[model samples]
Target: MLLKQMTAAALAAALSLFLSGSVTAAAEEHYDVYHYDCWSEAVPSQAGYTAERAVSGQDLGVGNFSEPTDIFRDSHDRFYIVDSGNDRIVVTDAELETVEKVFDTFTMPDGSETALNSPQGVYVAPETELLYIADYDNSRVLISDYDGNVQREITKPDSELFSQELTFLPQKVLADKAGNVYIVLGNITTGAAMFSSDGVFQGYYGANTVQTTPEVIVNHFRKLLSTDEMRSRQARTVPSGITNFDLDDEGFIYTCSQSTSQTQDTVKKLNAAGANLFSSLGVTWGDIRSYYDTNTNTNYQPMICDIEISDDKSINCLDLTTGRVFQYDKEGSLLFIFGSKSDQLGGFTEVTALESCGESIYVVDKRKNTVTVFAETDFGSLVHKATELYNAGYYEEALAPWYQVLQYDGNYVRAYEGIASGLLVKGDYEGSMRYAKLADSNSRYNKAFEGYRQEWLSAHFTQVAIVVILVAAVLTGLHFYRKKHIAKTETAERSEQP
Candidate 1:
């Protein structure tokens, strides 16, 4: 019995050691290097964006944040954190280390005061130094200055166009270069509510388009055949509401709709006339496939919560589902995807907003009540430089940076495309075709093939013409020889018969 007990103890100890070794190996293999392929499938690649550090209220000496909703970086590089639950806006310096200013209440010109109530969005005009706040619970917008002096208070419109039965609960606000205010109302499917510089109610702008399917066509036909009473009972077709939007330096508005059902026009770049400038461009906004989580055994579809436009025309979109920030170029090519849904420093819970300040990106997590800062990696820098030149129509000049990107991440489809485009512009059609094929870019490959065919035909034109002429001459000589031989044979046969 004693000998058997000793052997069993030894076996148990060996099994324990093996289990610990397996756990250590799993930990070592885990890495945060997620990327999207040509088909928008999330795959592992070199790290593009990493969470450098996280800044909470503790880091900034603000005690603790409670439900921080939005983050914005203005032209002066100032950081604004909308502390909604605290009913105040926290301002930090360019480094985000020291507190610059805090606004809790607004003093009106009439010697009255108004305090913020669960403010959700904040925007500061660069030229005029004006601040716009979307006071959510109050159902109004407050136009103020840096010192919290109220310039005007814009409430719900009393217009014939607006439905009186509905409520105006503004969620996000922004100002254009001309001082026009655009406010996004909750549950408003028509578009963003636009206002004039003087606080007059303007019409809506940049409404989302309704996606049409076969069912929608059938419904429309049925509606046409139904009576007015039946038509009233039928379900009305409406567009998905716009979730968030950002303004570029060029006065263009970039908008995103977070509806999973409405896949078309999920992201759009609108011109002044509310025309989608990127409609003709073949690009999808977010991940093309549903993200599957092994731990939860569930599939998640990304809902874009906010959008931030960088000075170099990079589109940074915040995903609420997986806490990932998907960065795209001006032409809608995915540059890098970073962040995750974890309790770790780089991960997030309830990501609400995003702001881009120069080389860094700040994301606000409402549930965690913290702001996570992400700095660009070396791979990210190379990709951004290549994208800048490529978007500017300098394909040949972008070749070096794109090649450097490939050195870091050979599987980067965009880099392959960039190199292909550069080769095409340099008149190296065959070389361009090879890169285009590698990138799986059919349109680019077709262009390269057409150029190659044209060049080959031009080069061998003389040889082809000589061959055609010689062939034609030989055929004519053969025809005449056969005719002459037949005539002689016929004459000889006739003479012999006589």
Candidate 2:
């Protein structure tokens, strides 16, 4: 009895560590791919930063591996990677010492072998201990326990849906505390498919407002389906279909279904109750993400192939199509972006995945069949640290950090801004002006913000300062005058009355 209880406690502790996201991607070093069995003669350099190879072979004990689609760390510090090519979810011990197969029993749909079909994204939600997946090709969202047991499938209905094809070719899947899962697509939303944690389909929200024509992607919302219109159709076609999507965490569902009078990219942030609290551009149509290099201070335009939100809330965008990584802030502001055009060690040429584990960052180069790790110390030597220094009001100290990253990447953007801004703050107007002009000269269009920052400061600092002073003065005058008047009025009224 004592032995059995001890074993159970140990198992529970391990599981907890595997589910925590903070420690999930922990690693001291990284792997650089030298070979892969999937694609012949593939080189890690071809994948750029997306190609951070994982541990080779089944050496870590997870048993023979297959084409790993996505890698995630659980709270127990165990690594769970979906080996889609092998039709299995692989796991690694807390120490990453032994790789083992945790879930050998995944539910195969009515007539399938094994379980998953072209599974894309794999995420283990600690709040619910549920593993959510974008079961691509199946047109469904498959749910499972952390051990890879398929518990349920979430799919949209057909008969009453707007699109002739109610296909859910889910590309990415994410889950929040409310048991709501977010699914991105290889195509557009038929309606943002909603489901409870138990796999009960709540209903669909957000129409497929996106229409891909032979011409440019339609930015017009009126041409697409709207929520109100869906209501009218739902009552006729199907009683449960919806048109408005309110993502609790993302804030609002910027459905591009409104009339054309105002339709850029419908950006809306919604609350848990589905109330639209904020609305702005969510994602753009036909928009490809680009990365501006802080080193060369040049911008590289690439098709956004993959994107992930880091633990720090920074959006890690990858243009594996062009071999680049674009980092954007939560506010949609572009920060320093970096990637290699070279096929060399320490530098990437292609990317399969870009993951940020709390202590370090990892990039998987599928072509090379290896993972390259970047420690925080390694990151501290990069332009990002300098940007941090600049952001923390330590402008002068940021110069060295930014300069080091420039040695490796010449096109990084924030580095230029750091140098330029730091100079401005230090009262080096000439240096600041030089950097601003140089920044503008590089892209031939002032794509860098250093010039803009300097110009804006030079343009409005005095006006803003004067406004603050005037407002302060007026408030002070009003306070004093009101007090004096009240006192005098009381004296006059008393004397007259008496």
Candidate 3:
């Protein structure tokens, strides 16, 4: 009874926090915070993206959706909504207004029919027009052509690479250009389960590292002192499980691991060899610290639930706790952050997935059973143009767009850095230094200072040399005259004494 009472009290406290945060957010309705650097925060003068509209079940002509899980937009711009609760997939046109087709049954090759069991994820291969579904209850990956004919089914591997004792439930899945399939299993802490095109289980790919704490280190020492039998009973640390993943146009798989306790490598770009190119740049993937909400007096750690990679290499990570989608450029610089947790149109109850179309972003709300589309604002366009040029090393050419970004949001730190880089390239060191200071880029400021100092020295070298020569000659003449005067005085005194 005491334990139950304590649990109830804890739940109530958590509910209070959520209610307070939602109330404050609804009252203000501002999604303006962007992380500039590890220690700095900036608010845009204008919202980068705004929720233009929401598409619910009523719009899909499907009465009402219960716990819709995933949303995907294929190359042909067709929208695929995985209606998990209904045990079916809803297909819509590019405009998302008309329902094109509904996938409820799969036609098997052996003159039989099978149905999906609470599919959580759906992926349509852009080239081959293949559909991959993670049938949760069925514990298999269902692959079919656009016509709903089951081409192949991926069950648990029969090889020793897979553990027979463990369940093979897949939550999310994606396919690469080479027909390689990757599935994110919820209970697998190793990584996403990888398989070849022939349905052969290869191995786990891109596993997160174990977060080392003081307790972990102590346990390691304790194991060294214990017997083998005792060591077997000790707890073994493991990597966090990957939640969801999406494939970019270039075939790199971008994944998100929803672990609030582990901060490192929450989002990653894994190459064909399963190496994380994101961490190779030595930068953090998301916000450096947990966001502190003053209204709720709570520190909301970022739990990245989903990732969407754009054609421009922009990575969008959806945070479940704050309902904010943190978007980063190709090189890991934060582009913009927008969203909130509320019952309003632009807000989200639960952010389950994110999908990127050309100029808009679609976020699926599991609780609301709707997908909210966010259209890019003029500010967002300017920011993207500037960031694209900046990341491409076209600093001078990016000046116009970067300045245009300032016109929209003067607080944008990247714009200042972009302008500074342009000025530095144009040999305007003083201007570069000024902008770099505003951007808080110490390396840029130092380089600009060095250039300014060198220019100053070069411009005044001749004048400085002439002054030095004149001072030396004057000193020598004064010394000789003083010596002659002393000698003459000595001669006169000697004559008088004689």
Model 3 error, position 172 (Å):
1.1
Model 1 ranges off by over 4 Å: 1-43, 221-234, 292-299, 446-462, 477-498
Report the candidate with higher TM-score, 1 versus 2.
Answer: 1
Per-residue C-alpha lDDT of model 3 across residues 1-498, encoded as one tens digit per residue: 999999999999999999999854432434554545424644434567888889998887976777888999988889899989999999988888889889989998786999989999999988789999999999999999988899999998897877889999999999888898999997889898989998999999988888787777898899889999998898887778988898887777888889866777888888878788888676555565667999999888888999998878898999998898888898888887888888888899988988888889999999999989888877788899889888989999999999988876678888999999999998999999999999989999999999999999899999989999999999999999999999999999999997
What would the per-residue lDDT of candidate 2 be over residues 72-134, giving only the tens digit for each residue?
666565666666665555666644457655554465546453456767666677667777776
What lDDT is obtained when candidate 2 is compared to the true structure? 0.53
lDDT of each: 0.87, 0.53, 0.86
Better of 2 and 3 by TM-score: 3
Worst 10 residues of 2 by lDDT: 237-246
Candidate 3: list runs displaced more than 4 Å.
Answer: 1-39, 42-45, 280-282, 292-298, 468-498
TM-score of each: 0.86, 0.53, 0.86
In candidate 3, which residue pairs clash?
Answer: none
| lDDT sort, best first | 1, 3, 2
